[model samples]
Target: MFTYEISPVFILMEEVVLRKMHSIIGWPEEDGDGIFCPGNNTMSNLYSVLLARFHLFPAVKTHGMSVIPRLALFTSEHSHYSIKKSAAVLGIGSENVIVIRRDERGKMISSELNSSIVAGLVPFYVSATAGTTVCGTFDPLNEIVDICEHHGLWIQNDAQWAALLLRTNQEVIHYHNRLQRAMCCSQGLLQECNQLCAEYLFQPDKHYDVSYDTGDKRIQCGRHIDVFKLAFEAQINHCLENAEYLYYKLKRTDFKLVFKGKVNKVNFFCCVFSNPATQREDVDFLIDEIACLACEL
Candidate 1:
């Protein structure tokens, strides 16, 4: 029963940001397609699963899950729980979401994933975690992709690293104008899967190009102007530098690395550097305070 109006300006902003995202992912500026969801990555995951379901069984949109065979989805044990949540929300049932094994470094074991695709259930989707939630280890994407290709499963890469990379104001500017040609490939699929073609809002007879009216491509009636906030730019190198500084500082203090060895890339604990305001003095104080608290324990 909820209702909302989509402004022309809001539609323009969405188009700009979607194009920016495509460029960031090294896709053609005008080639790929996507929609900015009112929710976070979890919602996006839901959309991805919904798209996969609809893609494989178009009748599911009109006829429901009863029309299709029992479907199975695969994800790493270390991946976000949203995959199962998506399954449950879509009436696919959480039991159908198969959990793949992860290695010592918390990366998904591709071999285990290949072997996990059991008999009877039609494996339609696989969610690959790029940066895991706990250990922040990246899954072996190439190997996983090969397996998914072999099984003819729809692959969705859950990557949050780009958000971390674009957290700072400096890095945002660095990559701002650097546009390239590549494709998301999923955008069109998403539109095809979810579009209701409501004539009231998405009237093709309108004077302006109706393609920018992307609200129909979503499941919800009210679409928020989420792209408004991303209008500003940010940087990554400065944040990475800050992370490296904290990494060495933490090493010298009472804090022990969760995984021992040389500190190469900044680990998950250095997320504070995402804030551009974080300075060396703050990092020093944090390290000292944590060490002091540890000693008191």
Candidate 2:
């Protein structure tokens, strides 16, 4: 059982960090909206779907699922299972979530996505994968975007791995801008969808700016201040560099690689380099350990 007491200071810090994140993701500073979630990417995925649902069918918020048609959302087979989990939790039914086929590299095939959009189910959202879970493959965004735009669907880029790339690589900045509605985690639309406006906590007649009271934006009453941790970890380039070093080393070794290329090329192996403290020597040691273990097998 986890709980936290939300404070005004925490809310201010969250807004600052979220705005910085938006800027880094290539959104104009004040254009996008976001909120910090107490859970992981799964929770974030759920929140994104919730926002999309509310965006498309605002009536569902008050009238319940009965008001809406048999709604459907789209995601790749290689995409996170959280999408399906989100569907279930939102009463959309897991079976209703149409799975689009992926290519050999584990990316959502745009043609298949286009073909999948039929008449019966009301397709309102598409959860495009920025970096997939197992293969680390990024779905073709340019193609996906064209289809999403034509179909008039809300696009949510599940860029859980994007922060690392945005910090280390500049080339992706252009590609990121094409994302229409939301990216990564929660969005500003969240406030509209989930705000309860509980009088005691979020009184509008307060002395301070009441909008700073971000806690009411979440379904949870007590939210852990996770934004502080994100703000503190400002150095991530070295971590990516170390991972790249390891990637090359593993390529030269006898170990059978799952995916032979980097993220942009085709696919990437999940070699975590998240810890800022990881060094070249540590990568070397890991490679050596893998080689030794291979010899045993």
Candidate 3:
């Protein structure tokens, strides 16, 4: 019923509220009758990665009459909490999920990840975050991908916040290994991709009748259509430029630089207002001032 354009910025740091579907959803690459929900692209990326991992492990395949596949996922301790949440929602035992250790920058240490896999954990899925909320940091995507490849694991890169991968100056040659599926909410890029790769990349299932009959991949049913529109609008409006403006302005101001990333999104270190011992009115005043300034623009 819907499709998402995948991105690779090296990405969820959002809560998604799902509404009821009016009908059975169909294949996203193709189309049919179904209720559609605007899924969070980040969540979709996470889910797809897990699904891809399922297809990688032959031993984890569905048994004779069962369709459920046992999956084990790996993520860093500093990674987003959604990884665990997704595992729980997907019926995978939370205990089966392994939290890989990370370095000082919160990037999962390659040795640990490899060790876990070599130790026969054989996690079918490994996720690396591009940007974290507490601190905007990128995990080593290429290296992790290599490790996954060596061990027959599928890797998913969360590029939700690092939407800047669309910038003209961005370089993604380092991340092009079997990354056939990705997710983005940028409309302009999706349209551009459709124009460039539409003919060769996407095709409707000729045997939709057979595949659609069983309603397989019901997990893939709720794809979102508006993600592209949102991304397009953000880029068209120079959203990243405006973010840069605020970032530079705040950095030059009395505030400190806590954590910073690309122009598309940035955060500042405001120890003064964030201190719990600080007076509430003072924090409120600062917040109000920022809000007023934002409204003026």
RMSD (Å) of each candidate, 1 decimal? 5.3, 4.1, 12.6
Give the per-residue lDDT of model 2 (tens digit) for 1-297: 011134656666667766765676677775777766655578778888888889888999989999999988999999899999999999998998999988777899999999998899999888887778776788888788788889998777777676446534543545632332223333467678888788776677877666677666677756667665455334566766786787788778775566554334534336766688888998889878867886899
Q: How many Å off is the CA of 133 in candidate 3?
A: 3.2
Best by TM-score: 2
lDDT per residue, candidate 3, 1-297, as tens digits? 222223111001010101111011112322222111144344554444444544553333343213444556788887777777777765666776889987765678888987787454336878787765555577888888889888777677665455334322242434533221234222122232222223332344433322222112334433334324323433433544544445566666655454333432445442211122344455446656976887799
**Per-residue error (Å), model 3, residue 2:** 7.6
**Can you tell me which runs of candidate 2 are displaced by over 4 Å?**
1-6, 167-172, 175-188, 232-235, 261-269
Question: Candidate 1: what lDDT?
Answer: 0.69
Ranking the candidates on TM-score from highest down gives 2, 1, 3
Q: Regarding lDDT, does 2 or 3 come out ahead?
A: 2
Q: State each model's CA lDDT, in order.
A: 0.69, 0.73, 0.48
TM-score for all predictions? 0.82, 0.85, 0.56
Task: Pick the lDDT winner.
Answer: 2
lDDT of 1 at 95: 98
